[model samples]
Structure formats: C-alpha cells, structure tokens
Target: MTIQQRKSYLIQVGAFLSQFKSSGIEKRLDLACNDPFFDQMLEQIDMAVHYNGWFTRENVLFSLEEWDKALSEENLEKWLKSYNFQEESKTVGLVMAGNVPLVGFHDFISVLLSGHKVLVKLSSNDKKLLPILANYLVSINPEFSDKIEFTDGRMNNFDAIIATGSNNTARYFEYYFRNKPSIIRKNRNSVAILTGNETQEELKLLAEDIFRYFGLGCRNVSKLYVPQDYNFDSFFNAVLPWAHLMDHAKYANNYDYNKAVYLMSEFKLLDNGFLILKEDPGFGSPIATLFYERYTNKDALLETLQAERENLQCVVSQDLMESEVSYGATQHPKLWEYADNVDTLTFLQNL
Candidate 1:
C-alpha cells in the first residue's frame, strides 16, 4: 500500500470513529460487553471514565481525533511512507496482553498499516475486544483482510515477533524469539512523586492514577514518592469520596484477598477498598495495590529513580521535569509508541 492508500484507510477509520455514536464501533463496544470474555474489560473502561469521572464525552471525542490525526496522511506520509511496502509480506507474530484496554493494539495497528501479516495470540483475559475492532477494519476494506490473522499456537512461520508480558514471560520470549527478529515487552512499574502541595482536586485526579483498571496496568501508579513528613490521611480523605467503587465485587475481591494474605503473613500493608496502602516498597506492578514512600529531597529521589531507570517505563508523579516518563499519562499511549521505548513505525522503517 502506498501513502495515499494508507491515508484513505485511516480517513475511513477516522470518519467511523469521529461519528462513533452513529458508527458500528460504539454499538460494537455495547455488544462486546455481552461476551463473557470481555465483560470485565468493558466494565473497567466504562467505570474508569465514570467512577473517577475521567472519561467525559469530550475525552471520548478527543481520543478519536487523536487516533485519527496520529494515523493521518500528513503524519503517515512522514511517519509511515518509508515504512510502507508494495509486495513485501512478513509474518509478524504478536503476543498481546490484557493488562489494560487494548494494551497491545499498537502491534496490530503497525502490522496492518505496514502491509504485513499478523499471527496475534490474544490474551485469554482480553480476547473479544481486539477481534471486534479487527472486524471493523476488515469490513472497511476486505482486501486488507488477507493482511492480518490471529493465532494462539506456535509462531514458527513468523518472520518477526512482538510479545507483551511480564518479566518472567520475557525470559521465555527471549528463548522463543531468539531465532527471529522480535521486540519483547518486560514488566515495568510506574511511579509518582508528590510535593504534597497539590490542590484537593489534583489529589482527587491522582487517585484515578491508582484506581483505574484496578491498578492492573503497567502505566497505573504503583508507588508514590512523597516529601518527608507528609500527611497520608489528607490524601486518603481526598479520595474517600470514591469509596463506593470499593463495593465493586471484582475490585473488592482483590482487595480482600490481598488484605487477608497480608494479615496472615503480616506483610505490613494498608487498606482502602481496591488499593492497599504501603509506606514504602514498589510492588512488581500496581495491580490492586498502591504504595508510597516519603522523600523530602527531589534531587535525591531523582538520582535513585534514574539509577533504576532500566526497569521503569513511566513516572506518574507531578511534572518534575526530571523523570523520563510523564505522570498520570500511564494510560493514554499514542499510536506510534509501543510499550516502554519501542517505536513501531520506526522499527518497521529500519527493518
């Protein structure tokens, strides 16, 4: 496909998304909620925007605009034209994760845009959403249909590979994709450093950083580094208004289970519905747990974080202008950037 061809495809997708209420995608999300496989994933997305009140209609529209513009002709002409091909057909295997909504969607988007075949192994935890979205793409232009496929079996025929999983799974991917050109995603935690001077409203928004997706995503805030002698009570109070969400059976289950385990083993933890409060220590990932430590010296904390930068993807704290990652944006990843540091279009271009 040429630049113009990809442009046409993106514009069509843009039109459908921009007019989502009138398009099948919105209806698709509604109908997708029925799938037992995706019911939980659907609930998380809907509730994240609602419970925290982050996903306004305005935000929804903004997402469509952003996605469209990211894939627009001008951007693609610059960003993707060199990546496009005429008859090149590489079987790119994709191993996706369900940590958050469409966690590995960029792999699919890149493979499709670059005219490559995909063998996607959808995470059992999130199987339905991607297929539904892919159906929309295939429906838009059936010819592009042959360019994509989904699979869970061995990707021995794959010419290249991309897999998203935990640090442990990365070991397996390293062994598996050793013989193939591959990009493997490893476990990384996101953190936030608080100055403790934020407004009540700012603190409330930061709470969203912890609770969204029940803190299961890689981008969700897992550990918070705060100034010395900070008041944890005030932060808790600011977020207390959202206590109703704790009643959610799924979230409560994780909270209760973790709490019980902590009590039994005396792991030293804090409790607040879906989040566990810890004075220090960054859990491997933020799933259903929020922890923080006090640090008066920003310079000292920055040095500590930088030393461990290899294992970190994002810093979810206030704009320190020193951390490599953005705070609170653990979720809103653009189309071009894949997990952590992998840039898909750039990879394809250099390939």
Candidate 2:
C-alpha cells in the first residue's frame, strides 16, 4: 500500500478511537465497519481489564483517547511531513512492552507507515487491545490483512527488530539482534525539577504527572529534584485530589506494605495518608512513594541531569531547560515524541 493509503487508514482508526472516552463509549453510526468492530473493540477493552490487573478501564480508555488525538489528520500530516518513505517493504519484528496500555502502538504504526510489514509479539499484560485494533485497521482496508501478524511464542522471520524491556533484557536484545537493524529500549524514569516557585495550579497538574496510570508508565514522574530548603506542605496539599487512588486494592496493598517496611527501617518519611515522600537520590520510586533530592547549586544539578540523561525518559519542569516536558504533559506526548529519544520512523525509513 502507498504511504497516503496507510495514512488514510490510520486516520480512520483514529476517528474510531475518538468514540471511546472516559465518560463512556459513544458508537458513531457513520464510522466504517462500526457495527462489527465497534462492539468487538469495547469487548476487547473489557477483556484486557480482566486479563491484567494493571489495565484498569479508566486507564485503558485514557490511552485510547490520547491516541485518538495523536492520529488526527492534522497531527499525522505534521508528524510525517519530515520523513521520506521507501518504496520497498520489509518485515519488522516488535517485542512490545505492557507497562501501560497500548505502550508499543507507536512502533507498530511506524513500521506500517514506512511501507513495512509488522510481526508482533504482544506482551501478555496487553495482548488483547492491539490485535483488535489491527483487525480494525484491516477492516478499513483488506490490503492491511497481509501486513499484520501476531505470534505468541518466538518472533522470527523479520528483517529488523524493535524491542522494549528492562535494562537487563536490553543487553540480551543487543546481543541477539546484533547483526540486524534494531531499536532496543531499556529502563527509564521521568523526574521533575521543582524551583519552589510553582503556582498551585501547576503543582496540582504535576500531581497528574506523578499519579496517572498509578505511576506505572516511564513518562510518569517518579522522582523530584527540589531546591534546598524546599517545603512539602504546598506540594502535598495540591496533590490531595488524587487521594482516591488509595481505594484501589492493588495500590492500597503496595502502600501498606511499603509503609510498613519504611517504618520498620526507621527511614524519614513525609506521609499524607495516600502518598509518601522520601528523601532519596534515586530516579525510580516504589508504588505509593516518590523519591526526591535537594540541590543547592543550579549549575551542578544541570550537569548531573545531563550526565544521567540515559536513565531518564523525561524531565518535567517549567522554564528550567530546553526540551523539558511541561507539568502534567509528559503522558500526552505527540506522535513524533519518540521514546528513549530514538526516532522510530527514521530507523524504519533507513531500513
């Protein structure tokens, strides 16, 4: 299929996705293949929730809503304008990550849009959603039927590979796909730099960045870099709205267990019933807790952040650095905001 054909098919999928919202699913009669695929898509989302404890209905719908915005005709055109597509197609292997809903959809689409076929190995945590979406795309055009394939076991017979996993698994990917063109992603955490001058509104928005998806996605801010003598009163108060998260059984269990361990270890902690703030230098934090470090010198902190860039997926801040993600905006990344700062489309185009 031509690039234009691929783009058109994807835009239709985006329109279909736009119908599913957090409030409820609204079936639009005008949508193509609405009768057959619309209800099936909804059932798949429900199945996803039953299959994975982390795949809450609200979170899954939020992911779909974000993609709906991303695949709009304008956004798609603007994002793809900078890339040149190749005429020949190759088979691209995808080992998807299931930390969050539809986490690997970007790579899936990138391969297709670059005029390549995709062989997918779905993460068990997120197996249902993508295949149904792939089917929806195929329903849009029968030509897409030959381009998509999913394997539950080993992934092979592909020209290139795109895999996401922990740092340990990344090493294995590097060695295994050594001779092939690939993009191998590793563990990354997002952090926020607090200057002690943020508005209440901004701090509240920052709470969204920290707690959304139960702080499971890489884009979720798990750590904070605060100025020396920074106070926690305002920050804690601003994030009070998310206290409802404590009602989630899984999250509550984690909070209880971590709180017990912290108390037993006699570590200093600032707790507000639902969330805990601990003074730590680490970027990744446990569930129900956030790590923070104090910096007295701005220049020193900048140097440290620059040095540890590979360990970070995003730096949430306000006017602190170039390319820093704004408060609460990390999760709603644009289509071109490639993960690990690696350009997937560029990788596919070259392949």
Candidate 3:
C-alpha cells in the first residue's frame, strides 16, 4: 500500500474510535469493571499483581487529537525511518506489554505502515481488546488483514524481533536473540519533576500522567524529583479530582498497605486523597500509594538525571525542557513519542 492508503487506513481507525466517543468509552470501561469476563480476567491479573483502575474509551479519546497531530505523513516517515523499517518486506515479531490497555500498539502500527507483516503475541491480560480492534480495522480495509496475525507460536522464522518485558527478562532476550537484530524494552520507571511553579488545574493534568491506567504504565510517574522548597499543598489541591479512585476496592487495598508501611517503617508520608507523596526511597512499578523523591539543586539534579537516562524511559515533568518532559502535560503525549525507547520499525530495517 502507498502512503495515501496508509493515511486512509488511519482515518478508518479513527472513525471506529469516534463512534465510541459518542457511545461513551468511559461508561463501557466502568461497566467492564463489573463485566463477568473482564472481572474474571482482572481477578487473575490481580492475584499476582496489584489491581489498578481501567482506561475508559474517553481516556482513549482524551489524547487522540495530539496523538493524531503526532502522526502526520512527514512525521510518520521520519519516525518510520528512525526505526529503519523503510522499503522492507520482512515479518516482524512483537511481544507486547499488557501494562495498560493497548499500551505498546505503536510498535505494531509502525510495522504495518512501513509495509511489513506482523506476528503479535498478545498479553493474556489484554487479549480481548486488541482482537476486537483488529477485527474492526480489517472490516474497514480487509486487504491489510493479511499483514497482521495474533500468534502464540514461537517467532523463530521472523527476520527481526521487538519485545517488552521485565528487566530480568531483558538479559535472557539479549543472550538468546542477540544473534539477530532486535529492540528489547526492559522494565523502566518514569519520574515527574515539579518546580512548584504551576496552578492547581495544571498539576491536576499532570496527575493524569501518573494516575491514568491506575499508574500501571511505564510512562506513569512513580517517583517525583522535585525542588526542596516545593509546596506540598499545591500538589495535593491539584490531584483532588481523582480522589474517587480510592473507592475501587482493589486499588484501595494497595493504598491501605502502603500507608501502613509509611507509618511503621518511618518513611516520610505525603497523602492527599488517592495520590501519595512520600520521601519514600524508590520504586520501578508504581503502587496505589508511594511516590518517591529526594531534594536537589535543579542544575545538579538534571545532570544527575542525565547520567541515569539509560535506565529511564521517558520523564513527565516540565523541568527537563532539553529532555522530553513537558510541564502541565504529564498525561498528554504527542504522537510518535515511542515509549520504552525501542522503535521496532527502525530495528527491522537495520536487520
């Protein structure tokens, strides 16, 4: 397919999504919490992992305009070649993350837009959503369906691979898959740095960056690197809108346990509604409670962060202007900002 064809395909996908905006994706998500199949899946996920809230269709709608802006033809071409998938016709295997609904779908989009076939290994936790989406897209343009597959089999025949897994699994991937070209995204923790320079409304927007998807995404702010003189009240006042998250029993339990840990272990505790502010040490995976930080001079702190960038995926604060973090915009990501630093399409072209 040509670039124009790709553009039309994206429009069809957007049209499908637009239908839900009126139908109200948020309501559907809330109902999914009570939906028998979804509830059953949630139980299995929550058994070993902490349960967090859902991302509604409205949540999906919330960021679409900017996301669409991020996907212009020139930008797609640049982002495509940035991952080196131009003029290629090879099978690309993607093992995606289920951290949030459709969290890493960009990798698959890149594969198709660049004229390649894809073998997707869906996370069991997020199986239903993607298949339904794939069916919708195929209905809009059936020929494209031949290029995509949801598979459970080993992808040994694929010319290249892109996998997102925990940090531990990254080492195994490197040892086994290193013989060929690959982009492997390991566990990463994203942080938010506040200068205490914003209004309540602005900070509330940033709270969406940390709390959306119940703080389960790699982009979620798990640690906040802030200035020493910052006012805690402004932060709390900003995040009050989301306090209702605590009403969900699954997330509340995490809040309760972590609150006790702060009290018993003598960790500095900062709690305003559902958001936790702690001088707690650090964590890669965000909990319902517990955000970390230590004071530092802004210049020195940025240099320190520069040294730590290899382990960081994307920072969500406005302070790091030279870096990707933008202020009052933690939850709103522009298009083509590849999460996990592994641009799958480019990895394939190099292969």
Candidate 4:
C-alpha cells in the first residue's frame, strides 16, 4: 500500500485504541470493524495484565490513550510532512522492548509510514496488544496483512533492522547486525533538574513524571538533580497524591525490598512509605527508589548533563535548558519525539 493508505490505517487503529481508556471503555457506533475485534481487544488487555504483572490496566490504557492522542490527523501530518518517501518497499526487522506497554510502537509505525514492510519480533512481556491491532488493521484493509509479520524465534530475511535492548544486548545487536544498516538502542534513563524555586504545582506535576508507569518507562524520571541543601519536605509533600501506588503489590514488594537493602547497608534514605530517595550519582535507579545528586552550580550541572546526554532518554525541567521536556510531559511525548535522539523514519528512509 501507499504511504497515505498506511497512515489512514494507522489513524483507524488509533481510533480503535482511543475507545479503551483509563476512565472506561466506550465503544462508539461509528468505529469500523467493532464486531469481534472490540471484544477481542479487551480480552488482549486482560491477558496482557495476566501475563505480565507490570502491565496493569491503568498503565496499558495510559499507553493506549497516549497513542490515540498521537495518531491524530494533525499530529501525523505535522510529523511526516517533511519526510520524502519515494523508495521501494523493503522488509525492516524490528526487535521491540517491553519495558512499558507498546514501547516500540514508534519504530513500528515509522517503518510503515516510510513505505516499508515490517518484520517484528515481539517482546515476550508485550506480545499480545500489537498483534491484535495489526489484525484490526488487516480487517480494515487486507493490504496490511502483507505488510506486517511477527516472529517468535530468530528474525531474518529483512533488508535492515532496528533493535531496542539494554546496553549489553545493544552490543550483541550491533555485532549481529554489523553487515546491515541498523539502529541499536541502549539503556537510557530520564532525569529531572529541580530548582528550589519550583512551585508546588510544578513539583506535583513532576510527581507524575516520576510515578507514571510505576517508573518503568525510559522517559520516567528515575533521577533528580536538585540544588544543594534542598529540603525534601516540600518535594515529598507535593508528590503525596501518588501515594496510592502503594496499593500495587508488585510496587509495594519492591519498595519493601529496596528499603530493607538500604537500611541493612546503612545508606541514607528519605522514605515516604511508597517511594524512596537515595543520594546517588547514578542515572538508573531501582524500582520504588529515586536517585538524586546535589548540584552547587547551575552552569556546572548543565555541563555535566550535557556530557551525559547520550546516557539520558530525557532531561525534564522548567525552561532550564533549550531541549528540556516540561515537568510532567516526559511520558507524554509528541509523535516526532524520537527515542534516543535517533530519527527512526529517517533511518528507514535512508535504508
């Protein structure tokens, strides 16, 4: 199919996904292919939670909502307006990540929108949702069936590849795909730069950045760069709204286990029953824990962050830097916000 046809199919998929939200599932009469696909989609959501404890109903719906917002006609037009797609279709192999629901969807859509076929190897943690949507796309237009393929075992017979994994797995991908064009993504964590002058409202929004998806997404703020001698009382109080996260047994178990490990090691910690803050210079923190470093100078902190940019997925702040994402907006990225600062559509087009 043509690029426009592919985008039309995706817009329909987004419409289908928009029905399943955190508030409630509202199946509209105007949606196409609602007969068995709608009920099947709900079944897949339940199965997602059953297979992976991390894929809660709220988190999965949040992901769906974000995608729905992204696939609007305006957003897609703005995103793909500049790309020139006059190339022959090639099969692009995609190795997806399962850290959060539909984590690798951007690459999946990019390959299709760039007028290429996609061979996908689904992450075991997120195997169900995408295939159902792919089926839905086929139901909308049979052309998609020729364009999408999912493999459980080794992925081959593709022109190029894009793989997302941990830093170690990235090295393996690079070596394995050395002869072909590829984008090998490594582990990256998002961080927030907190000035002492931030308003309580802003800090509360920052809480969303930290706690959303139970802090599992690469865009989730796992570390904080705070002013020296910054008091924790205000920050902790601002984030109180998310204390209900303790209700999740998996998160609570992680909180207890991390707290025990910290206490046994005599590490200094600030605890609020649900989340823990530890003074660490690291970017990636354990679940239920946030690592923080104190910065004495703003200019020096910027330099340090610039030096570590490659290791960061996002730098969230309030007008602190030119490219910084806003306080609560990291997880709600725009359609053009390519992960790892690598343009997937450009990569696919070049291939």
Candidate 5:
C-alpha cells in the first residue's frame, strides 16, 4: 500500500478511538467496522486492565486519547513530510516496554509508516491492547496483515532493531545486536524544576505529571528540583485530587512498605497521607515516593541537568531549559517526540 493509504487506514482507527473517553464509551462516530468488532475492543480494554494491575481504565483511555489525537491526517502528514520512504523495505524488530499502556506503539507506527514490516516482541505485561489494535488496523485494510507480526520467543530475521528495557537488559540487547543498526534504550526518568513562584494551577498540573500512570512511565516526573527554601504546603494541597489513588491495593501496599522502611531508617520525610516527599538526589524513585533535591542557584542546576541529560528522558519546567516539557504534558508527547530523543522514522528509512 502507498504511504497515504496506510495513513488513511490509521486515521480511520483513530476515528473509532475518539468515540471513547474516560467518562464512558459512546458510539458517536460512524466507524468503518461492525458493532461486534467495536464491542470486542471495549472488552479488550477491560481485559487489559485485568491482565496488568498497573493498566487502570483511566490510564488506558488516556493513552488511547493521546493516539486518537496524534493519528489525525494533518498530524501524520506533517510528521512524515521530512522523511523519504522510497527506499527498499525491511523488517524492523521491536522490543516493547510495558511501563505504561501502548508505550511502544510509536515505534510500531514508525516502522510501518516508513514502508517497512514490523516484528514486535510485546512485553508480557502489555500483551493485549496492541494486538487488538493491530487487528483493527488489519480490518481497515487487508494489506496491513503483511506488515505486522508478533513473537513471544527470541526475535530474529529482521534488518534492524529498536529495543527498550532497563539498563541491564539494554546491555544484553547491545551485545546481541552489536553488528546491526539499532536503537537500544536504557532506563531514563523525568524530573520537574520548581521555582517556588508557580501558581496553584501549575502545581496541580505538575501533580498530574508525577502521579499519572502511578509514576511508572519514564516521562512521569519521579524527582523534583526545587528552590532551597521551597515549601511543601502548596505542593501537597495541589495533589489532593489524586489522593484517591491510595485506594488501589497495589499502590497502598507500596506506600505502606516505603513509609515503613523510611520510618525504620529515621529519614526526614514529608508525608501528606498518600505520597511521600523525601530529600534524595536520585533520579529514579520508588513507587508512592518522590525524590527531591534543593538547588541554590539556577546555573548549577542547569549544569547538573545538562550533565545528566543522557539519563533523563525530558525535563519538566516553565523557563529553566530550552527543551522543557510543560507541567502536565510529559505524558502526552506528540508523534515526533521520539523516546530517548532517537528518531525512529529516520532510523527505519535509512535502514
């Protein structure tokens, strides 16, 4: 199929997804598929949450909505205009991460849109949603059936590789795909820089950056760089909307365990019933906890962040850095905001 045809099919899929929202699903749009297929998708969304405790309904719908916005014809055309897809097609291997729902869908879309086939190795924790969406894509156009494949075992017979995993697993991928053109990603976390002048609305939005997906996504802010004399009262009050997250058993368990450990160690902590704020210099924090460090000056903080750029996915700030992601937008990256700042489409087209 031509690139326009492929993009048209995905636009149809996006139309179907836009009908569903976090509040409820509504059949408002005139979808191309039958009712049974749409019904099955709704069932799969619920089944995905059941299969993975971290995949809450709200989070899954948030992911779907983000894609629905991204798959517009204008967005697709604009994003792909710079790339040349006339080169010979090859099979691109994908090692997907399951930290959040549909975390690897961008790479899947990139490989196919670049006029190449895709062989996906889905993370076991996120095995349900993508295949169902892939089926929906195939239903939109039978030609797509030849473009997608899924494997549970070791992946092979591909031209190049795109892998996302922890630092340790990345090392294995590097050794295994040493001779191939590859983009092997390691663990990276996002952090927010607070200037102590942010309004309550901005602070509330920043809470969304921290608590969304239960702080599981690399884009989720796990740490904060605050002014030396920053107060916690405003920040804690702004996060009150998400206090209900403590109702989740897994989250509550993590909270209790982490709090207990901190208490035993006699560490200074600021707790507001649900989330814990600790003075830590680390980038990656445990679930139900947010690590923070005080910065005396902006220059030193910028230098430190620049030095740690490789270990960071993105920086969340107002005007601190040139590439700062807005307070609430870290999780809702656009189609071209490739993970690890590695352009998947360029890689695939070159290969």
Candidate 6:
C-alpha cells in the first residue's frame, strides 16, 4: 500500500478505537464486518486484565484513547511529512517492551508507515492487545498482513532492529545485532523536579505522572528532585485520586512488601497508606514507591540531571529544565515524541 493508503487505514482503526471507553463501548462505525471485530476486541480488553493484573480496563482504555488521539489524519500526515520513503523496503525486527499496555506500538506504527515489513517479538506480559489491534488493521487493509508478523521465539530475517529491554538484556541485543543498524533501548526512568512554589493543581497533575499505568511505564515518574526542606503535605494530598490503586491485590502486595523492607532496613519513609516516598538518589524505584532526593541548589541539580540524561526517559516539571515535559503529560507523548529521544521514523527511513 502507498503511504496515503497506510495513513488512511490507520485513521480508520483509530476511529474504531475511539468508539470504546472505560464507561462503555459503542458501535460508531459503519464498516463492513466490524461487529464481530468490535465485540471480540472489547472482550479482549476485558480478558487483558485477567492476563495481566496491571492491565485494568481504565488503564487499557486510557491507552486506546491516547492512540486514538495520535492516529488522526492530521497527526499522521504531519509526522510523516518530513520523511522520504522512495527507497526499497526492508524487514525491520522489533523486540517490544511489555511494561505498559501497547508500549511498543509507536515502533510498530513507525515500521509499517515507513513502508517496511515488520517482524515483531511480542512481550509475554502484553501479548493480547497489540495483536488484536494488528488484526483490526489487517481487516482495514489486507496488505498489512504481509507487512506485520509476530514471532514467539528468536527474531531473524530483518535488515535492522529496534529493541527495548533492561540494561542487562540490552547488552545481549547489542552483541547479537552488532552488525545490523539498530536502536536498542535500555532501562530509563522519568523524574519530576519540584520547586517549593508548585500549586496544588500542578502537584495533582504530577501525581498522575507518578501513578498512571501503576508506575510501570518508563514515562512514569519514578523519582523526585525537590528543594531542600520542601514540605510534602500538598504532594501527598494531590495523589488522592490514585488511592483506589491500593485496593488492587497486586499493588497492595507490592506496597506491603516494599514498606516492610523499608521498615526492616531502618530506611526513613513517608507513607500515605497507599504510596511510599523514600529518599533515594536512584533512577528506578519499585512499584508503589517513589524515590526522592533533596536538592540544595537548582543549578547543580540541572547539571546532575544533564549528566545522567542517559538514565532518564523524561523530566516532568514546569520549565525547570529545557524541554522538560509538563506535569501530568508524560504519558501523553505526541506522535513525534520518540522514546529515548531517538527518532524512529528517521531510523526507518534510513533503513
């Protein structure tokens, strides 16, 4: 299919997703053979929660809505406008991350949109959702069936690669795909920089950055850099919306386990009955716990963050650092907001 045809088919898929939400599902499309697909996809969404405890209906719908917003005609056209795709197509191997729902979707979309065939290695934790969506896309345009392939074992027969994994797994990827052009992403965590003057509203938004996706996404704020002597009363209060998360059996178990470890280790922790905030300089924090460090000087903190840029996926703040994501917007990345700041479209075009 041509680029315009690909874009149009994606837009139709987005429209189908827009019809469903956490509140209810609706039949808003008049396409041929859509009823069973819609009903089954909704069933898959419900089944996804059982497959992975973190994949709640609310979180799944949030991911769907975000993609629905992203796959618009305008967004797709604008994002692809800068790339030239006249070169021969290649098979692009993708090793996806399953930390969050449909986490590797952008790369999937990127490979297909660049006119290359994609061979995807799905994360076991996120097995169901993307395949269902891929089925929808194939239904929209049968050509995609030829362009996309899912593999359960080792991935091969690709000209280039895009792999996301932990720091340890990335080493294996680098050695295995050493001869090929590749984008291998390692562990990276997001942080929030908080000044003493942040309003309650902004702090509440920041809470979303921390609690969304049960803090599994790379964009989820895992650490906080706050002014020395900063009071956390308002910060604790702002996170009330996510208090319901503590009710989840898995999250509650994590909270209990982490809190017990902290107490037994004699580490100081601030708790709000649901979430734990501990002072730590590390980038990655455990689930249900947020690490924070006190910063005495803003300039020094900026320098430190800049020096540790490789370990960071995003910085959530209000102009605290250059190009920092606004509070509460970490998860709502734009079409061009490439993961690890690596331009996937350009990578595919070059391949």
Listed in order, each prediction's TM-score against the native is 0.80, 0.98, 0.82, 0.98, 0.98, 0.98
* Candidate 1 minimal-lDDT segment of 10 residues: 19-28
The residue-by-residue lDDT of candidate 1 on 213-271, one tens digit each, is: 56676766788888877877778877786586565666667677777877798777766
Winner on lDDT (2 vs 5): 2
Model 2 backbone overlap count: 0
The ten-residue window of minimal lDDT in model 2 covers 40-49
lDDT of 6 by residue, 2-42 (tens): 78888888888788888777677788757655887888878
lDDT of 2 by residue, 301-351 (tens): 988999999999999998879979999898899999999899999899888
Error of 4 at 62 (Å): 0.6
- Which scores better on lDDT, 3 or 5? 5
TM-score of 6: 0.98
Q: Over 4 Å off in model 1, which ranges?
A: 17-87, 267-270, 322-327
By how many angstroms RMSD does model 5 differ from the true structure?
A: 1.1
Candidate 5 residue-wise lDDT, 90-184, digit = tens? 88999999999999999998888888899999999999889878988888788889989999998989999999999999999999999999999
CA displacement after TM-score superposition, residue 25 of candidate 5 (Å): 0.5
Residue 37 accuracy (lDDT) in model 3: 38
Model 5 poorest 10 in a row by lDDT:
28-37
Residue ranges of candidate 3 with Cα displaced over 4 Å = 22-87, 283-285
lDDT of each: 0.65, 0.92, 0.65, 0.90, 0.90, 0.90
